[model samples]
Target: MSILPVSSIYLIIDLISGFFELLEYTFYRRAMITGFLASIVFGIVGTYVVIKRIVFISDGIAHASFGGIGLAFFLSHYLVFSFDPLAGAAVFALISAVGIGLMSKKKVQREDTAIGIIWVLGMALGALFFTLTPGYQTSMENVLFGNIYMISDVDIYLLSILVVFVLVAVFLFYHELQAVSFDEEFAEVAGVKTTFFYLFLLVIVALSIVFLLRFVGIILVIALFTMPASIASGLSHDIKKIMLYSWILSLIFVMGGLFLSYVFDFPSGPTITLFGGIIFIAYTLARWVRV
Candidate 1:
């Protein structure tokens, strides 16, 4: 007997057909390219994120990035020169990442509380600045929730540069990062600069959050960042293997989620998040039953 329910089997068939029909559009192709590029960095950085146990910090930084976007708008209007929102978001996220890292290191506030403070402050600042921005902010929802179908050629180019940077940086710093991630105290004793590497990792994550903002938005980006590595970790304990597996799983989830959204006329970002969640749940259950 077929393992899937009959209705699900039919739905798959329909999705396959609809997916092909939609592929003729330039937007769909761009979305596909975006997925491929984003998945690489997601898998790499996410592995570190999961292993280092910093998912919450990543979320805080990602959300905090919106303040940068809002500031970009304000600056453009306030100073009378064009300011890139992505640039604003990048700068904002970096500051948040450094702030969170420094605060967590200083012992003045609990890490979670520090993260929470930045998260709240970011949202508040973004809202205040956005309200002050002149005219209707046509792209506001896109920043909040993401719209994959609206990606442009320039966006793809920038994302491509990010993938290259993340890949090369990780490859060069892999041993130091691995050391610091697994043992801050030991790494420090062993001559690894734990503080520098720790903050460096967060900086990369900040950059990744800014670039990923366009695909899944601030609201949904954390799921995209964390889910792939979490799913891959369930399959392997080796960090290297986990990174590779995370990339493959990310590709599957992104393409599958993209096609499903298009086939059913669903909202892209949330649909992708839910799609990953379902697979994650089913995988966990299967593993539990096996154990």
Candidate 2:
């Protein structure tokens, strides 16, 4: 009753792998190496992203970076300037994070509303600029829903360096992060720089989102960032335990989805997201039943 040729799909992937082995000296093989590195970085960063309750902001940052992507393309094409789309994305994402943090200080609007407005406006600007620039649509489409097979060795190196930076920063500030997440007022009274930690966390989330966009794309990056942590948080009582569980869970989803996609001729992003969603739902249901 299934429409898919499951067996044939596996055969095709096997053939593809064999072909890749034959072309092992080529740049395409380097792309796969970069992809693996990206996957690991996403797993670790995603844990903190979910723990901090910044899923909405992560989505906004990812979407907002589209404007930067557009600008990068326009500059590279029209202005004769060589620009890296990821670099531009990182810059804009950091700017957006700062704006979001400042807006949080105001009581006039909810944080969610501010994030939504920024998200839409950023996307609109991206679209407008893209339309004005020739040959921009193709580049935007790729950024919107990444082509994983195009990853490069340079990309892998950059991602690994960023991963190390994020991990070290988190390790150094774990207590402050935990305090701010649990209770901002109490954290401030206890001598934690709550505002600084909050801003730092948002900046990290923004950078993670930008890094992940090349692998999962803007549409599904939020799921990878939030779902594993959401499920793990439900099962763990302590923040440290939650982060540990979340990292394990994220790795499982990435490895499982990547393998399954290769076996089933499916897209990687949705496969990972779907598996994460299933696990999250199952965990929730089990908790409900136990309670």
Candidate 3:
């Protein structure tokens, strides 16, 4: 007589599972907010990054920051300080940025070659530093793959401030950034202070990379920086539209990946990256079909 009610109990269990799923999604929503803020900055800057053929430069900075991560671990272990690895990363990355910027001015060496040298040297330093430090191996995993659950309220506040700062700066210098991004020689002729802007952009990139390392880690951070913007750029013809789509797509990936990871018991950063790759491939295929 009660057999007919079994399906109702199953449905109730399903509903409870769905409710927990929704609750779990709140974490991912926070991740999406962080990713949204990050991708917008990256999208605008990454457009210029890709346009200037400085993709390798972004990779270089991302990798070079590993030195800072290792140093941060050493400091955290020995100095009994509570310094965020991200802070150390930003400091070192800014140094690398300045170094790269200065080297770019030298006519004897190409920017790519200079960046390549810095990249290798930076990683080597990081490896050496980590090996010299005690109690680094366990924590180093977080630096490489990231732990999205570590996104604290403080991090959210910091990321919010950075997003606002970058947006305002970009707005205030829209014409200048556009000019420099499109044609540095023309921008220089037009009194855009090309060198200043170049340096400024590098610093901004460094900051962005640092903030990203917490969620995506040093190894996969560049994928977050470049992939959404690349997908959006392929889909949009206008700069504004590209940025808009990039943020939206980034939001989708972060949220979707977070949800999937929670549901499937997978790592957050890799899930997000895998989601971004799928979106990029799907978008590319769609465009190819249309063409």
Top-scoring candidate (lDDT): 1
Q: Give per-residue CA lDDT, model 2, range 31-121, as digits (tens).
A: 4554455555555566667766778887898888888887877787778678898887888889998888878855567999999998987
Residue-level lDDT for 109 in candidate 1: 93
TM-score of 2: 0.85
Clashing residue pairs in candidate 2 are none
Q: Which stretches of candidate 1 lie over 4 Å from their true place?
A: 1-18, 134-138
Rank all candidate structures by their lDDT, best first, as comma-separated numbers.
Answer: 1, 3, 2
Per-residue lDDT, model 1, residue 173, is 92
Model 3: how far is 183 from its true place, Å? 0.8
Give the total clashing residue pairs for model 2: 0
Looking at model 1, report the run of 10 residues with the lowest lDDT sum.
133-142
On lDDT, who's better, 2 or 3?
A: 3
Which sections of candidate 3 miss by over 4 Å? 1-32, 80-82
Each candidate structure's TM-score, on Cα atoms with residue i matched to residue i, is 0.92, 0.85, 0.87
The window of 10 residues in a row where model 2 has the poorest summed lDDT is 26-35
Candidate 3 accuracy as TM-score:
0.87
Answer with 1 or 3, whichever has the higher TM-score: 1
Candidate order (TM-score): 1, 3, 2
Residue pairs with backbone atoms closer than 3 Å in model 1 (clashes) = none
